[model samples]
Target: MENNMFCFQCEQTLGGKGCTRHGICGKSPEVAGLQDLLIHMLRGVGFYGQKALEKGRKIDQDTNKFVIDAIFSTLTNVNFDPERFVQYIEKAAEIKAYMKELAGEIDGVIPAAAEYTPPMTREEMLKEAKKFGVMADTSLNEDIRSLRELLTYGMKGMGAYGHHAHILGRMDDTVSHFFYKGLAATIDNSLSVDDLVKLNMEFGQVNFKCMELLDRANTETYGHPVPTEVLITKKKGPFIVVSGHDLKDLKQLLEQTEGKGINIYTHGEMLPTHAYPELKKYPHLVGNFGGAWQDQQKEFDGLPGAILMTTNCLQKPRDSYKDRIFTSSIVGFPDTAHIKEIDGIKDFSPIIEKALELGGWQEDEEDQKILVGFGHNTVLGVADKVIDAVKSGAIRHFFLIGGCDGAKPGRNYYTEFAEKAPEDTIILTLACGKFRFNKKEFGTIGELPRLLDMGQCNDAYSAIKVAVALSEAFECSVNELPLSLILSWYEQKAVCILLTLLSLGIKNIHLGPSLPAFVSPNVLQVLVDNFNITPISNVEADMSAILEAAATA
Candidate 1:
């Protein structure tokens, strides 16, 4: 109830206010304060890096990577260890040190962000953390506060994409350059609301490229996704369940465990990996084991296999499964055994042995399959059919109803909205949010299933590409087409995607389970006036409005 350590980075931030004393995701105030400090220092690093870039000077490659990783540290439920943030804070300052020499002194006046003192120990970092709370500010105006926080939140989302793409050894210099630009702008008080608002849109544009980079990284590594039915039930054997969005980790784990008498299944965002040609080639790479990430604690209870988290969306692992849990990438819990890569090799032997020890459901379980892997290529492969169906009145409209899933009350709205759609309509979904309605059969519109699963959240890029192609075929802009976007968001990645839609001038988006706490009323009005982003209330009313609006259009 107290706003001692303020954070609204997630949908479940306490009471739709701030995670004052602690986080709803089981984060402690100590860790919350440190996260805020880490972000503040990251902006400080951005200030110098961006200033250098302005004078035809270059940003250090390490600076580019550190800024992305530091920003990602602030993502909800990613890192709970206070020590990680402490290290991140010191690392940010270290990047700033190199950036300062590159930038030199600016006009004899050092920007406040350019100021940095390298901490020799943890105590110094803690003392600095006392001063960098999210609410701590130079100006007390609420509008500026809102806009600044909004920019930072948007960049947080952008940073997450950059981090994911970087993991695949894919780096976009253009998108990477803007990371510092956006971060530096957040620390600059001279920028007006208009400036911040414009930067917000640019963040969206860069995020589109960032998401595009990740999509490229994925598709090139694994083949383009095909419409494969992923089994939801676990099969019998010693097994390992991979979670999160990292396909590389999944592929490596699958390869390592192949011929080793172990079964590997996917959990959460890893469901779509079943369709990746390179990953599916390994026979031990079996099926998907559970629903969304939010249900892991319940679904994993007494589960015999090991669980490896590749990225964020990790809940506090329950003690029941914590011993069997392993983590990679930026995800961390205090006692979990983490798999780190040495040169390009990650040793998954620990997870393998643990799975063998616990064994698995020894009896073959009946597998209930969930349809996924309908990426842009697969959908557009049938473009002629889809186009003819739309023109002939067999398919009237398409709904893009997908984003991150979470443990919130209004999430059921997604399930209800998907179920209540007209039979002639096509429902396109992605990300963990698909779990809500994925198992339910939407039948088909001619040869196509009414509900199309377009892989994970990053595959929103595929959805965007599909929409653009659809627009080209119909000779109309995206808004002119009979497509409606109903999105459900939880974390920073969702923020980036929403900004992407807004940047593309996509309008009339119905966003829920709730409006972002980071979006101020003025910013919300700006979104409404410029992009017509609406918050969802009643599913029946919203669906009727969408249908009625499309009918008129």
Candidate 2:
């Protein structure tokens, strides 16, 4: 290991160990330490926020903003600038201190912000900083360990989404407190696996609320997403491809370039934006660009247009088109065009000008098209057909092949799972994980595509909506339906999504490529007993087990 700071909070860590020297991400130890400190401060704010809400003191927008910023600031590939990140930490500290002061005032015990500067070393903080009571360390058995880590990673992703929605004026203290309290819990050593299992479900429960808040924030601002086919072609003129997981940033780009000739194409998690009624209304919005996040270096090399990243899943850009990349919100690159917020609006003029300067493909080319828009609304709209298909054996099985992406070779399991899916089976995918097999044509049963890409990871809300709708149509519980959730997790967003599924009592979810670093054995048993959660095996074997179980059930 290189003699510098190292942190591996993401799935693609160096050599499956904590990244040292520099990350595959090109992030240095200094920035990694700052990111860790930022998370610590956010936890403090979340903890303090919980106390304030408990005392009947309402959390103001500033408190909410600080919390959200703190969470998002730590996301993968977002903020690599230590100076700016520390500014966010200091800002968060100030907000947390103010909230503490307010809480004290409410209780008639006036106090000052914790007048303490963090000891200026990563080793010290990692060693002695107060641990959140909720972490499930590596002391447990493998199965439980996996789930605990799974939940924590998902919370991290959910925190990012929650923070973004907060910026849009959407507030959910119930959800916010969960992060603080949950992180605090993960650090508890005495808690049994059963305790962790229950807490894991709560993470999902709150995540569901968070996703709903985001859904409402988005649909209300944009419109309830409708089923619209997105074109996946490179236009004959100048354009820009916007990727990552932020819809607000996408919307801002749409607003900023309303009449400009530059067309906007969705990439990665942004692919589902086409389903949004408001965003799709723009004719300038083209189609999806390349595949998943992991494929960007190849897909983006010497691209004909500029790229705008709103959030995570950014790999190091190759020199071929590195300069064309622009980042906003928490997404940052060393020298990429940073679209700063000006008067509450993100000005994307630089990217737009760049797009025009470098005109896209010279001639309009015929690009292959794949069907999207199979989100919750679209899926539920065809609920009757799906039910009939299930009953009639047109669609024999339903596989929810959703989760995160990773560099592990074992991830081929997802591809094999999707590929080996029975012709009559339906695959519902979300997040960047779907990229493994989404490119293959699965054909459709009538108008429904066999492979339905649910929006982003947060759009797991769509999967739940479809499941519940199907259940209602069949007059059965979700677990009683012929659905199997085979999840691939890599980060915190997946945690929140898994929690949402568990909170709904959906069971028999098969998770992979590996379990989380948290989770105790007792907790694993609790989840297995209650939800029947299990780790994934070979695709064929897992498929056989699922099909056999469905046949017997």
Tell me how far the alpha carbon of residue 5 in candidate 1 is from the true structure, in angstroms, after superposition. 1.0
Lowest lDDT 10-residue stretch of candidate 2? 128-137
Relative to the true structure, candidate 1 reaches a TM of: 0.97
Candidate 1 lDDT by residue in tens digits, 1-553 = 2336778878988899788776888887777777877777777778887878888897756668888888887888688877777778777777888888888867644556568564666666666666777777656566677777777777777777788788788999898888778878776768888888888888888889998999898888888988887767767778998888788888888778878899888888888888888887788877888889889889888788898999877888888898999998788888789888898789999999999999888788676887777999899999999999999999999998899899979899999999999999999999999999989989988889999889888888999999999999999999999999999999888888888888898999999988988777887898999988889999889999989988887
Q: What tens-digit string does per-residue lDDT give for candidate 2 at 6-90?
A: 5555655666655667766667766666665665566556555656666777776666665666676666666676567757766
Write down the lDDT that model 1 would get: 0.84
Measured with C-alpha atoms, the lDDT of residue 51 in candidate 1 is: 77
Any idea how many clashes model 2 has? 24
RMSD of 1: 1.7
The superposed Cα distance between candidate 2 and the true structure at residue 193, in angstroms, equals 5.9
Candidate with maximal TM-score? 1
Q: Which stretches of candidate 2 lie over 4 Å from their true place?
A: 1-8, 14-17, 20-25, 105-116, 119-152, 183-197, 519-526
Residue 251, candidate 1: how far off, in angstroms? 1.1
